[model samples]
Target: MSSDMNKDWPLYEVFIRSKNGLDHKHVGSLHAADATMAIENARDVYTRRMEGNSIWVVESKYITASDPSAQDPFFDPAEDKIYRHPTFYELPEELTHM
Candidate 1:
């Protein structure tokens, strides 16, 4: 592997907002020497047309997520408990949005 592609730099997840009317979305990832460099790289790759106003660079290592393969047993217990739902009670108008 190239020295630039070596283990020195960790992976990063890049998110960018293209315009005022659009929401930021995951564009792509790149190995940057640091956060600032990651942002610059993400801009070059994702906003070539000056397409974005905002950029977010998150180190992939910092992200913690549950395993999708365990979803059935991990989440299915709540599905059978219909009483947990508040549909039977009429909520006051002031609390309607809740």
Candidate 2:
């Protein structure tokens, strides 16, 4: 592999705003030399029609995510806790939207 191809750049996560959407959604990730290159690469790969007007590229190293394997310890304690659920609450007839 060439030096450029072999060079290990930081991974970047890309978000794109579709033509009709008001928010940018995470589309994919790629390894890039820097943020600028990542944006260009994301544009080429995600928005072929100039369909997206906004591009956000974040370093993968900075991304923090929840661990699914720890789900039981992380969230299950709240399952039997009925105070967290709203189903038992009664609403007034006049407050239909609420």
Model 1 spans with C-alpha error above 4 angstroms: 1-4, 75-98
Candidate 2 lDDT over residue span 20-43, tens digit each? 658988988987888999998888
> What's the distance in Å from true for residue 74, model 1?
3.9
Roughly what TM-score does model 1 have, to 2 decimal places? 0.65
Superposition error at 20 for model 2 (Å)? 7.1
Quantify all predictions' global Cα lDDT against the true fold.
0.88, 0.85
Off by over 4 Å in 2: 1-7, 19-21, 49-51, 88-98
Tens digits of lDDT, candidate 1, 1-98: 68777589888999888787788888788898899999988878878888789999999999898999999999999999999998798877887557
